[model samples]
Target: MPTLRRTLGLLAIPALALATALPATATAATAAHADTASSRTVLPDAAAAGWLARQLVDGDHFESVFNGTAYPDQGLTIDAVLAFAASRSSDEAAAKATAWLAKPEILSGYLGDGTTEAYAGATAKLLLAVEVRGANPASFGGVDLPSRLRSLQTTEGRFSDRSQWGDYSNAFGQSLALIALHRTPGDAPTAAVDFLANSQCADGGFPLSFGQPTCAGDPDATALAVQALAATGRTAKANTGLDWLAAHQNADGGFAAAGATTSNANTTGLATQALLSGGRFGTGLKGWSRLVKFQQGCSADPAVRGAVAYDATGFNAASGTRATAQAVLGLAGTPLSTLSAAGARPDSPTLACPAPATR
Candidate 1:
């Protein structure tokens, strides 16, 4: 039998100030306003946005594919959450993030799926997430992490498996690892930085992997790398990536995943995050506004509400929490903010989160 997993909890505090500050009439009036006018061009204040960020921060836990069981490994999810949470100065969120990093599974690897070796990129992301949440440098697993990180490096200076490398050279893995290395307060080799600069495609975006036919940089992957580079004081390289992203904006004021056939909340959200990291907040704000419109409540559909859903040609009722989380993540630059605002929370203990077999 297939096992069930409960990844994260939904802890929402009511936005009493937001609700009370705006009377029912004003709220309804704003809802009735046109998308252009209703979508605030300015990024929401960090405090105003904290509630949503918390939702994103807490929703990172998902079931481990190994051992046919569920476990909370924030390593995979905390980078993005910490970015948003740190911006808001959320003390509670910081504490939770710190606790997750201190978990043994992060550095030593989780005890499932045959004790798979921890990936360099995953470990790097976890470390950055912890720091963003306000953990001390000592809170990291100490000198062991740097040694393990070095071990994952290829002779070419890129990280990840040589044969099946995916997105490492192109800013995804390198970016996260760079942030971890930068935060460790030790001398890092120049080769790693050199590898990132060399991986840039002629079009100015990073690919999902090195030497793949598709050199098109994905918005989400690019965003991850952009932030990583920025963290490591590589502002110029980060700017180039951001420039490429800005050039790729669609006519709809949003971003396409790669080739620009369609705009998606996932790609758009990442683009927004990247832009924010690069200090291009104005450009990111426009894209985010467009995304918020796309994620407007699912009143037109019954299976999902207040969440984004996708289908090639027909609606798929089976898509569940993962889709919701992705859409929420895509919309808010963090997960759970929009979901809470819409009053929908992930159902615990086997919340259905199925992605399409093929994207």
Candidate 2:
């Protein structure tokens, strides 16, 4: 028997295989299968965790959703690590992931990229991930991840990055920064709360960027802003944003991004967590229902079990890992700030696997 490190559950959807790993075109069976009413509804946590668990490459790491290979994809690995720990489905994988992250090579590239220099979003996310698993961000992997995050903060309390993807470095990264710094309140920027509150649009939602002459509400950014505001006991503000979100829920029980034409599991999952954080589950349940249907189950091909498509359009590897992983958070009803241990880590079931085919 394999020497078990700790309890672990992961899933690998065949629909999630890297684009290069498959033929030039998606097969009809894989592309045409959509979640219908008759589809068996599995626990969102179980379905997503099972899928996340199977994707572990070695005893310690998750395969990249982008390449379907076992490389040092620490940036993406953090999502699965936090998801498994939050769902109580895989402690071993979480622990092993923590161990793997302690290595220097995997983290070196994440230090920065593009014009913004430091990968500010990556650093903030890692801080949140380490904290989620009960690990110390201050000393994880030789460098203090939390300290690194704070160093990136501006005096204005805005955690902005002006890089190639700098446009994406606003509310999303700022939200994570606020949550991570909350773990160490003293060190967190005092102006952080106000920064987020100021980002809110007249519609009671927040935009993905700051300094916009006008407020344009983004579903994803609004959701995260709600959670971040709630952390500071700003229920009045949080509720305002939540109300905007409530009004925007698509009849299908899901939400789209600020300007997107279609609703997606990824946005729904994110909004779900934010609503739960603000104590607004009543408005979020329909979306939750829509969210769960995205996961593949026994009725689907065995290889695709536990997979979650981004939306009804069907599953695509491009969005599978991120969409499913985020869905698990909503399915479990645990927000990013509340993902500490509820069930013991040892209580999770195991998924059998072959030895790592490659490092």
| Total clashes for model 1 | 4
- Candidate 2 vs. true structure, TM-score: 0.79
Worst 10 residues of 2 by lDDT: 1-10
Which candidate has the highest lDDT of all?
A: 2
| Model 1 regions lying over 4 Å from their true place | 1-60, 64-84, 87-90, 105-107, 110-116, 137-143, 161-170, 230-236, 294-359
lDDT of 2 by residue, 209-264 (tens): 88888889999888888877787667788899999999998887788877886888
Please, what are the lDDT tens digits per residue for candidate 1 over residues 1-359?
A: 00100100000112223433555567542342222122232222222223333344353333334577656645434533443442233334444445555666644553111124446666555545554544554436443555556667777778663223233334566776776676666744568866776677777777767667756677766776666666666778778888988888777667777655676655765676567445575676566555444432312232332333332222233332233334434334432111111111222211122233685
Pairs of colliding residues, candidate 1: 52-337, 56-335, 167-208, 167-209
Task: Name the best candidate (by TM-score).
Answer: 2
Q: Over the full model, what C-alpha lDDT does candidate 1 score relative to the true structure?
A: 0.49
Q: Tell me the deviation in Å of residue 59 in model 1.
A: 9.1
RMSD of 2: 9.3
